[model samples]
Target: MSGEEGAVATETPLAALGETMDLMTALQLVLKKSLAHGGLARGLHEGAKVIEKHAAQLCVLAEDCDQPDYVKLVKGLCADHNVNLLTVPSAKTLGEWAGLCKIDSEGKARKVVGCSCVVVKDFGEETEGLHVVQQHIKSH
Candidate 1:
């Protein structure tokens, strides 16, 4: 991530771990809120607002699934518009989170109405905040 498009990728495990930890915390917080509030609509709404705010400087990790169309659409649009897209390894965490999302769809749990959205929101805000702190610390 040293070349073009303003990439700043780091290959350090600790750095990646820190990112995961921070993101998990944010997800937990948002999940708790959604559970308490009895729906993922409010949670996703809050996430969208945060994502819109940090659209320029964030890499969103979307969970991959058999339904690649919708997954890539959301992530790709964000990327085409300049937001970064990172695909995560699909797992039960995402599935369970979706189950908790309070969606009324009978199709599948692929709706952007659950933990993935929460993680996207968490990634945006936390990553943006960390970047701001990094810039500040560097300047001073």
Candidate 2:
């Protein structure tokens, strides 16, 4: 994928943006693992609600989220709750990895353009992958 809006490719677009590519790859891996561990919350509303209740352990805000306020809310909530926040360069990619993929009636993959988060209720095996994500967030 070229990381351009409206691109139909489903491949990870990690080759064109130097350090950003690295960040995207690392986040993508974490999202995949988090999904497998059933610790993900997909979409802006869901993420915000989770954060509002102080349930999220780590949050991934796509850099291209459709709603700017979504980003602000997530950031402030994360700060207030001491949850880690990381940014993925593309919302589409983040959505796909977080199991939010959908196909339109026209048979095209719909873009995931909102915020996604990892909600952990307790510190257990489900949060094992969060350590890697936290390391990446600190470096960025």
Candidate 3:
């Protein structure tokens, strides 16, 4: 193959692998993996503390959070600490992804409760999903 064609062939696999998962799906994978690895700090207060300490790798906020000040505080902290920030549409969905809510036998959240924020401290050995999430964050 020609030089240009060889480069394109090698790049194609990487591009495909990166695009295989959407942002939300990759985010969920990261949260789930982080949960088992004890890398997550659930709730706004805990998340803020993590960010303040510069121990956070990523911070996720729920778009439907009731407290605007808390969101702003976390945003500022993330910026100050150079941590990546992401937002999901619903707190309930975020709670589920963060494993804050208990799952029922029927595969549903036991309560209507939700967590507004989560701080990711470590991605553990499974860094692919985290890498994907960080790439998405950087691109936007």
Candidate 4:
């Protein structure tokens, strides 16, 4: 085999491995995985509780949260605990990703309005995506 062909064969594509997922999509994937594995906490109250307990691995907030105070509170908690924090554009989307939405007859997520915060206590076996997200946050 040629040298270039051998190198290409041994290399792994970042996108194929999920390393190329954007921050928002990575956050959603982590939330979904956490929900299924039992380490997800939804909403301000539960997220704060998790952060206060020093159990939060990552904290995700919605940029369009109606309550400024709630956003400040979660940001403070994340700062105090040194947990990784990320923000998405909308709480409704965040809620859907956090598994708070109900499936409609059309098989799409609906209702449940929005969630202001979501804490990921653990990423279970699917942690590479979360690590990539964390690295992205740290670099920015």
Candidate 5:
């Protein structure tokens, strides 16, 4: 192949991969902030409950989640309440990041629910990560 065609072919997939990695990195940051601070509520039920009370600042949903009704309900509530919505790549990954797993007494892992809502009530002095995630979502 010609040098131009070879360069195009090589760069196309890498560019797509880069975008995917960037989103994953951003998702991790959001998750970390949500967990470390007192602003996180994990799982579809918890998130929806917070949204129902108009207490959510932002909502993140895993794009690969199997629960369509969960996504639909959260999306509708977010739109109605003017909360920001974000999509990650996988529910499992998001669950791990949100610490939605527990090690049983038998040393086996149990998966908890997925999805999360970031509450803004206790934002306090740590707003950097929040702004970064908000900006990232807006740009995307």
Candidate 6:
């Protein structure tokens, strides 16, 4: 029994350019624990919806072949919507998110480079980032 190879190979590319990896990674911890404590299917479904709402492109990285069945559902949505999804640098979701966040120089917001996968077009260095985040959230 091995982990899903495909899932472990893809790292969140946004992680390198932004700050939301921390939030994403932390959610993995909560989700995994929830699953272990009897919250896998229902809880994961709810969380996945929230993440999907927030994330413009949802990347579902697999830890191994034994990846949870629930994640498969999320991946199906991603496929249907044509959202860019990747699976690599895998771990229990949160572990991987933390891993990516550590590398994100801009992984913060609210004067801290907040972590959301939204960006302003044609904006320069003088842009108000929080506003950008708000707009990004609104657009989706």
Candidate 4 Cα outliers beyond 4 Å, as residue runs: 1-19
Give the RMSD in angstroms, all C-alphas superposed, for model 4. Answer: 8.0
1-140: candidate 5 lDDT, tens digit per residue: 59799769864764466433455665565565667676778776677788888888777777876767867887898899988788777776677777777868874548755543333323333444455566786887
Please provide TM-scores, in order, for all candidate models, with all chains considered together. Answer: 0.34, 0.61, 0.80, 0.80, 0.64, 0.31
RMSD of 3: 9.5
Per-residue lDDT tens digits for candidate 1, residues 15-127, read 56654344444444334444444433222345345446653333334464455665555575565565544333543454354354344556344443334443333322233
Q: Which 10-residue window in model 4 sums to the lowest lDDT?
A: 10-19
Clashing pairs in 4: none
> Top model by lDDT, which number?
3
User: How far out, in Å, is residue 69 in model 4?
Assistant: 1.3
Model 3 lDDT tens row, 1-140: 59799779974774577556778988998898889899999987788888888899889999999888988898889888999889999998998898877788766777656888999998865556677787898898
lDDT of 4 by residue, 33-138 (tens): 8999999999888888899999999888999988888878888999999998889998889899999989997769977668888999988765566776878978
The residue-level lDDT of candidate 6 at 91 comes to: 40
* Candidate 2's TM-score: 0.61
- What are the runs in model 3 whose C-alpha is more than 4 Å off? 1-19
- What is the lDDT for 7 in model 5? 68
Q: Please, what is the whole-model Cα lDDT of each candidate in the order they appear?
A: 0.42, 0.64, 0.85, 0.84, 0.67, 0.39
Poorest stretch of ten by lDDT in candidate 6:
113-122
For model 2, the local distance difference test gives 0.64
Pairs of residues clashing in candidate 2? none
Per-residue lDDT over 66-95 for candidate 2, one digit per residue giving the tens place of the 0 to 100 score: 677767777888888888777767766766
Q: Show pairs that collide, candidate 5.
A: none
| Model 2 CA RMSD to the hidden true structure, in angstroms | 8.7
| Greater-TM-score candidate between 2 and 3 | 3
lDDT of 5 at 37: 73
